[model samples]
Target: MIHRLFRHIDAGTTSYTDETGANPVSSYTCADRLDRERRTLFRDTPLLVGFSGRVAKAGDYVVEEIDGRSILITRDREGAVHAFHNVCSHRAAPVAQGSGNARRFVCPYHAWTYGLDGTLQSIPDGRSFDGVCKSAHGLSEIPSAEKHGLIFIRPGGGDPIDVDRHLAGLERDMAAYGFDRFHHYRSLTIERQMNWKLCPETFMEGYHLQYLHRESVGPIFFSNLMAFDSFGPHTRLTLPRRRIMELRDRPEEDWRLIPETAIIYNFFPNVTMVVQAGHVEMWRSYPSGDATDRCKVQVSVFTPEAVETEKARKYYEKNIDLAIRTVDGEDFPLSEAIQSGHAARAHETLIYGRNEPALTHFHASLNGALGA
Candidate 1:
């Protein structure tokens, strides 16, 4: 990471683009396009649903709503993670409600019971069914896996996903951070008035940091000086902190990645994995109820080790608070204004500057995924 930083510095420039510009307004803003995206892109592709630490033990489970699909994720006694459609085979009512440790999930509507592994265990009445196969009527399993401490699930119309391949070999690189060993500390979910893409897009670049975050995070980090590395549809954006210049006096061998540079990994579709000084922050955005104009952002923080003291806890608390204020207080309000502009058709087409190559690659890749 430091090598790349110095490379950009030596070249007297950060990453760049040719004169071939891109239209920012060229997005899936219409209802039809959003429907198609939900059906084809999100449904058929693998999605990072939760951090593995969320269900760190046997009998632990969590119910997540992803793109209109209610999903039940569980870790069984044997320590295997399973994902299933939360719907009961009996009356289609959800077998699981929220999150907790459960030997088995029982449908709240009736008495239909399901094992943690998603098998139908019992039905209150056996005679009520006519030619029903209990084994065949278990909860429908979604293509999912717990890889590198992250749970991935495909909701509908998709083939099984090879998580390693899907990550474009990032699993090996991410091992250095020990994401699987990290403990989830906190999470916050909020509804936004902008499109889901806007949330991740806002994080893909630091070009706006000097301006948008000038008072908050801007002074601490460089603006528009970023290095982009693509791993298939996923990308890693390395933005150095102002303190990174301190490494100049030290030997190149003493250079370290963490604490020096803030690495932002864009896990394609929605997840933004931010490597902070000592912990990790994951921000996930989901399209709301098939609407293109609205989305939900579920942000979480994970630590390599638990914050054992009030001072440590307060430090993390302040960091997260700063992030919340910067994004929700500053960035999101701008997103709302941009959404209003788009709604009013303010510009025939918005343009991405040559400096914003990450946005260019993202939208282009999105268009490819949508088969535009």
Candidate 2:
């Protein structure tokens, strides 16, 4: 009966149904999906990038990659957050290296300079070019907005949708976890040899925990899972507690012991947030090319008393390290191998088990986006 339920959810929409009366998995194998994601979704659409805590100061900045486009995120003199294409207007050279405090960005290729506001301030020998206009030659501006302590950038050149409206239900979820008060401690990236979709899908369900993470994490979490409603293209999953004595026998009214022990939020296309009892970790997956996907998983450990004590800081860091190493060393390698297997057979369709509702939702959403 559970297997039948899995088939029903995995079957997806009419557009993805196979002629053989079987459910068809959307083809993420095509270069078209990758290309579209790069051009339309990453470049053109507004994508959630990082938290605001890292660049709270006016001069602070961070260098990030979006859909293969290098981006420079910074705050202006007035403290407004801005994003610009990392490439300089002159000779297309990269204006900045890895992130740090920068009053202005200078193009190394030809000594062109641009202010944090993206204004082209100087060019070597301004009089040499009679018709050259600095205003028209400014660095390309990418739309960026901050909300719920998160930074979002739109690479496609146009007005962006309000971040608040786009985040709708997610805002409440974050609020419930006191995300606004959460502080960023550190971030780490894990490069995996798998389709970008695989990372989030692997994390969306707890069914694999019993087998894959048995020795490490399985003891702390329940295998049977419940999913919260979908928020637009995003879905959230709630993992019940397993052996933790503090949570085991509590009534539903006493859920505050952990306040939903674990919450997994998938933010469409390729971003996911895992909110644990003590910290919130985020994963942003980007396709490296047609065949490989590189994912950046950031673990942000938050506690009101974190900055107050050195031991608290060390404890959080150690926990984060353990989590990152376990996922990187164990889960991702398996996911990469699976992705290779999937691409090896063009006609084969993958199946999602009953408890894997998040994966089912993901495939269905992808089909809708691709109009497949």
Candidate 3:
């Protein structure tokens, strides 16, 4: 079934096409293109990176990986959000390991210190260079912006694009998910042996829900699925039936009250979000490099009541754990096997069934962007 609902593009048209007939694989999936997209999307433009749920306050911080670059996102004393290259300027050490609260980041290597605002506070050798320019050598500041409870960052020291412009239709639908009202309950990371594209592509449609996820998640969703709408490179797919709670013998009344059982938001290039009834989870996949075709998938879970109560917190945590086991334990291993099979000298072009419209759309977008 076709669920086509087009939203008018209000912003001035931005061209996204390749001149050459030769379609270049996504710069996101391509190793050589990492520097380009990183510069353009993360460094030059304010791309959404985090949510303003639990960590929206001053001194709250999280470590994120965007386009293969590790980033440390922090809110300053004044509650202003900022981002920096998570790598220490001194000795190239990783400034922060995982997510936590920090007033200052001290590099585990050589003990170089930096303020929460990305200012280089002190170096071990204060006397070594008497007049060394410290102001010019602070931690590289990545442009960042906060909107609708989401934190965005531009990684490549470039100019930033308007966040609202990028989030046009997404904002409306996401608001319906109560994204702004939700709090961050849990976050998890999964290392997959497959290409980054494989991860998002896996959730692009519900065609595989009945076949691949039958035991774990299949029995809960509808057989006939619909995907509607595309803005720029982003797309959203809506699942009609209440498959998730079906296993629990949930009543139709409960289903009717729920906004959507499944809503998958594909943010062009690498990120994808799965909006469920109770929580919203986002996955950012980064290709390890160009040649290997291996990628890392980072999953962040957000709920509307993480900081509210202990029971709410546990509920979110349990939900996150179930999701991780299903995706990482089941989906990822299969994807990895597929990638390896595709890479074999004996294989040719991979095939996509007609029912897999999401995957088809993804490939079409990839081809268009890369000039394939």
Candidate 4:
């Protein structure tokens, strides 16, 4: 963004990092430490689940799984967004199945119904219970908020989730994109045998871009040289294209932040966003369950414009395919292989290079969140 660029120019540097190096090993491989992070850092924190376009209409709703919690987020007729535990009030069965336009969510177990506002509407057999208070039970509400065209919820099923406070000023810069106006294109949810934290680290640095993605997006981006900034626990990493220098002579009003650079917002703990000219890709990783060794990623791509033509659709389809190959094919395979070493009782500590400051900041934030 121009704002960020100006700040970088003012500082006379893209970013800063202490040249002193440190080794962090237990945080990555220790099962107990991983569990602590899952409980304190990932679960208690508000997570970016989906974009606003997902539930754009009054009745549009989406079902998401966050850290093993089934979250049901919906937009009421009043154009207000609400979130609740996906389980039915009775027998704890899932109230909503997948995501679609629905006035009410019916439990497949016994037909217990709930309104879009999360109110208990009816029961199949009202007389089945002697003393039942229908009004006393509704879908358990969770903290949720819709802002800047994105949806966030706290999976801990607590009171109102203060999503704004969590951003810590990153919201102002993030709102510039007007993500709420974007269109959700396609998504892929895949299960993998890898630590949840390692998956996101793969996207935080350009050190690997040249080596791991050299055959794919590497050539298109200026690898190794990147601009970084830290906001609370969040990180802004800019991988400027070789053409970014063209903006130096152009008028400020005529400059465009996207296409000329690959800006990545690493929303600590789980969400990572890649903002480009045509679209934005959000990758959210959730711990599969109590198993720290397993994780799942929900990859959703949003386009500022509709893919109305067959060629456009094919381009996106091919884009997603290539992204999968670059990550699943090249990056994740290496992550899994690296994770295997954690159990071999070989390396005790892994070093964080000065060049990979974003990675270092991320791990430090994660550690601080876990009260390490």
Q: Give the winner by lDDT.
A: 1
Q: List the residue pairs that clash in candidate 1.
A: none
Candidate 2 lDDT, 108-211, residue by residue in tens:
88889999888999988888867889999888887898877777888787886588677757778665655556666666666677767777777777777778
Query: Between the candidate structures 1 and 2, which one is better when assessed by lDDT?
Result: 1
By descending TM-score, how would the candidates be arranged?
Answer: 1, 4, 2, 3
Off by over 4 Å in 3: 1-47, 123-125, 175-178, 242-260, 307-310, 345-347
Clashes of each: 0, 3, 16, 1
Q: lDDT by residue for model 1 over 301-338, one digit each (tens)?
A: 88888778999899888987887789889998999778
TM-score against native, each model: 0.95, 0.85, 0.80, 0.93
TM-score of 4: 0.93
lDDT of 1: 0.83
- Least well predicted 10-residue stretch by lDDT in candidate 2: 13-22
lDDT of 4 by residue, 197-278 (tens): 8778888887778788889888876666678888999998887776776787988888887868888888877888988776
- Evaluation by lDDT, superior candidate among 2 and 4: 4
Residue-level lDDT for 19 in candidate 4: 76
**What's the TM for model 2?**
0.85
Judging by TM-score against the true structure, name the best candidate: 1
Give candidate 4 regions above 4 Å deviation.
1-16, 248-252
Query: lDDT per prediction?
Result: 0.83, 0.69, 0.67, 0.81
Which scores better on lDDT, 1 or 3?
A: 1
